[model samples]
Target: MKRLLYIITIAIFTVLIQNSCSKDFLEVESADKLYVDEYYNSESRIFEALVAAYDPLQWFDYAWGQYTHIGLVSDVMADDVYVGGADANDCIYLHRMFNYEALPTSVVSDLWTTFYSGVNRSNIVMQYMDNVQGISDDTKALYLAEAKVLRSFYYTWLWKLWGNIPYYETNLTYPYIADQNTADEVYQGIITTLEDAINNGGLPMKAGSGREGRVSLAMAYMLYAEVVMYQNDDSRLNQALKYMEEIIKSGQYDLVSNFAGLWEESGEWSQESIFEINYFSRNAVRSWSSPTTDGGSVYPKFIGIYNLAGSPDYDGGWGFEPVRADAYALYDDNDQRRDGGILNFAKYAEQTGATYQARYQDQGYFLKKYMARKDGNANHSADADLNYNNNFRVYRYAETLLNAAELIARGASGTGTAQSYLDKVRTRAGLNAISPSVENIIKERRLEFLGEGKRYWDLIRSGYAPTYLIPDGLYRTSTWTTSKKYLPIPQSEIDASAGTLTQNNY
Candidate 1:
């Protein structure tokens, strides 16, 4: 019998069955017979349930390129990295995003749904672990550790996107309601979860071959470090620094020689990656907003050239998100990453058969990071259905180094050590070295983590808010001090919570 756990509410119970020789052994059980106690009694059932916990990570828009879009567009609109085009309704929101006026329903929906779904899945796995039998105690501990780490991940996203959210632990099976928790409460919960995972030695220091995609001790430490950095709690800085130092001293990870190789399809499980989201080409599904019936590919759709013979029809809907003239100008001509990271809009148009008509005449560039395709789809077909199975790199060794440098710069009593950390990243980018000044460290972060969905959080952690540009492009101003830093809780979630949860003040 397949034991199933009902997770809709908070109550937890079990069901039993009786069999007789005269009766059919295959007699079906009542649907209501399914309960948590009955299901969690075996190891295999628990393991399968844990596997289901990982599903929410791949939600379209919220996870992949769309995740990058929210941060990049917001940053680019504020600075000179990119500009809005005629058809760039989304970019318009980006430009004015800091203003409470421009918050879009799509952004709100994506943020809320992605993180809550992640939280719910993690809760389910944690709720029923004791019932899993036959597994060694150590193995069960390890699985629990992974669940805690994953829960921290979801909380991290929630902390960054919503600032304050309702914190729920234990599986809620009855659709009970709860009020919102403060930002500090949310941060503490994330820290607690990560610390428990780390102290328990639940995650392996190094990933085993069969556990390639699983979170490890190194990842847990790194995530803890990130949370501490964001919280900006002075007392936690040393702890954050300690976590980073441990990862570095462990010697399990290294920086890849070539930055481009980091994203190359061939580099999926490279040593430099501490943690990354796995996306297989064979199982690729189109993002929810994609217009095509056939699920589209994320990479080719975002980075492929505009028009090339035998190339897939990328809706050419909007031209590639070009490198902003300002961001482009920030780099020296010799910087390899400038060209390596960005694809010129004009160059892309010539390579792909798709036309590169600018939606907004003034804002003309599209992104070029993941543009290459194994093969182009047929015309008018789903061009996004290309064989680009690039895994999204979430945590990398390079980031660990950067995190250390940032911590050291923020008043860590280090003697000339911070500069070396910052230099390593600059050296990799083929740029001149920078001193340990806070501004320089921030600039290095901005340059190194471009288009990776780190900028918005970086700004918030650094106590900087999104600066808005007027429609006429006359002046740039910062409006992030308002409630804009934390996105509003989704209207749908608010409705679901009824009067139990209060909406964030916009």
Candidate 2:
């Protein structure tokens, strides 16, 4: 029997389960005995299945960590921020990742395990769709499409980080020993899955009223464009452009005028969001051991300034993921994006008359995009201060614009379209528009997405990682290599597979 623990939060559903986990992976959960047949005999059960498919998005062990296994790790691995905390040893996984010495057993390993857990959960829900009774065929098709797209989203992260990996569409049997697929095969599979969902699965261009968190055509298009763009192929670039253009023409999404306002609690689920991982604070109660409950995100609390006195509108935080001086230098002083993206700790101290000790090369700059507040938005009780109800923006309209710009700059049709999209993001940042060039688009994306967990992938996808990241003083030890691009598979997984699974050259 699968021992399931569902933490029902204000907005998102989070389910954690324990099955016969192997020595190598805490990922797979048996679905054979998930629920009795009568449980799926009602329409409510179908909705519950859909929610369960979405539940893994907020797992504390997966995404709500001090440095989220997926989102925040990319920036830390790149040249954007330092792993700032009490000392050098705090959150050793992030430090190791930044320095490029992460062992297979380190905290980063959990990302593989957890993301696969999401994949499996999505698979379970998808496989059981046929068993659902009395749901409309359209409704059933939409739910199935949602599961596939969500699986694609999860798999994209896995393949992006791990290169070639085991791929399975159906739920695995016990003692699972799956063969790994090449990265190319995996990418093609992901694209095919999403394309199928978009073309045939009856998903609306956008979710219906008040259905912002659910999967939509816009989300599918965004993911499709993003994955193909990462491949950097010319023929597919135009296809990606078409999808992004469709998203823009759909009129279902738009960028929030105020960049800073994007992070306010009131502005969550704003028009800018294409797909956002929902987290909640209301009705949530977190504990040290549990760390996350009620689907709240810990990224905000982890990146906030530590041990500082509360100001008029702000609160202190655990103070990990400090912004480096070089990252701060990326912006012009007057760039609203800078002011909105990073907390100027120097000026903050001057204003608040607060002082504190620094650690882990802290330059006093903190992440501002997801900073937590003390205004009763975090939790119903005084506890769980670390669990902030900040929804993680997985895909935004701004990014779609950027993607379209990059595609156009890279030989897609619509000459002025690239510059037009660039100007939109620039105008939002209160900056004058610059002519569109691939270099300019790259630089614009870096500046625009500072702490939003994109700069690193931007570097890699643009083929600039070796050029820009290697010479940076922040990277410890040897030079960066293409082989180092993928993190090593956990050794325990290899041992469990008994040679069925091969490890990446980390």
Candidate 3:
């Protein structure tokens, strides 16, 4: 009864649903593709369109056979992880990316495709909403709000990494060209879309009950704060801080006591979660032939131990991201995150007699957060690796608290003092409370958000990239420079755009 909604499914459904949802509001009757004009005449159809806007975020390059999580590339590009796989051919691009050596030809094109697919679908929904029937003004407002927020979320990724991307509010036609917008322009566009969504006043402070997977007002706020901070927009610092405070004051979210528990199967959508891209495997149908179909994530399989026989603790995997020993040593022994967040495969193998082949650049460590587990991909035919049930927790309460504390430390006014906000997260993680100085918050975020893919950006925005990202001989031979901020635009996109898409000056 699990249905995975997706972008490629769009060709099969004009509005978006083809057993695409399991139940409740997301459930819709499957049909052959219809024209855009023929669909969206009812409230139900319009809802389908809105859901389509969210579907692309779930896609992770199953079709293309690459780890294309928005966070995946960012994490690989960071300094802490080694691109561990069978060899370079299996993960060369990732190794190159981490080394700041990825060419435009070798770019992870799916990152570009997935988010833009979302952007286009979101725009299509709003365009069709104008003519949709059988929905009240209130419902119309709500759907529009959702569409705009989703659109902004998608664009935020493009703006941050790609920079100077083809930006648009409406789906393009004919030549299918969009204006090449600078990062600054994209920022303006995202802010405008988010502001409009907020003014629509149709979203809830938090998603609850049946709306577990949908975006909420607070999620938008978190994203708004994320965008503002990364951009270092001085004017919006106070506004972003206010949004973080609103989530904190709402009492809808709090840190779960167990830091290690955050990665468990039970932790998928816990109290700490603000937003997550959901994946399901109980009835997974997606396979190599139909990569576009609904199924669980292939990400866990990619990061799992390569060439290892199955053990009581975990299944054998391709082993793509071996944690560096230096990064692993950052956690104090008393910190639950060390024991819980990361797994020392060497230590575990010694203690439990579990065996695994050491992957390339093996540091004897693995990210326990998203590793494959026994029964993790159950119900998928034979190919369980492509259907892990790990949902991507995009935003969490801990991040919200930390965001607030960081802002307060930077002198933004807030509901609570910066120290109190910082302490809540630190104390929860079995550490003594410390001053919320910018330096401490920075280190705290490094430990707290590691491998979740905030580190590279954190280093960049905090002006730590130039200094901290020195040319390490192994993975980072090329020191990070200002020009390397944006990834090179995929050459395929440039070819498709003909003259519209220009390559980034990487």
Candidate number of the best TM-score: 3
Tens digits of per-residue lDDT, candidate 3, 1-506, equal 22234433343345553453546456544466576687677887877788778877767545556678766678877777877887766767777788787888787877788888889889978998878877899999989999899999989888888989988998899888777988999999999889889878489998766577787999999989988898898888899999999999999999999987788778877889898887778777767776656678888888888777637877778888888888889988888878687888778877778888887888889988888878888877535667888787789899999999999998888678889899998888889988889889989998998778888889988988888777776656778889989989988888888787778989
Greater lDDT among 2 and 3 belongs to 3
Model 1 C-alpha lDDT per residue in residues 1-506, reported as the tens digit of each score? 10111122223456555656646567777777666657666776777666656655545333532433343434553443443434446534444453335443444456566667778877877787776768898988888888888878877877776777888777555676666899999998889888888988467777877566677888888889888888888988887888787888887887777886666666656778888766544433433454212222354455333433443523332333444656666667777666666655555557664444444433444444455445333232323443244456678888888888888888765333787887878888887776878767777777777666676677766765444233334323444554666666667677788777666675
Predicted candidate 2 versus true structure: per-residue lDDT over 379-455, tens digit per residue: 34425654567777778899989999989988998534898999999988888989889989989988988877788
TM-score of every candidate relative to the true structure: 0.81, 0.89, 0.92
lDDT of 3: 0.82
TM-score, predicted candidate 1 vs. hidden true structure: 0.81
What TM-score does structure 2 among the candidates reach?
A: 0.89
**Candidate 1: segments with Cα more than 4 A from true spot:** 1-34, 60-106, 283-320, 346-355, 361-364, 376-388, 413-416, 466-478
Candidate closer to the true structure by lDDT (higher is better), 1 or 3: 3
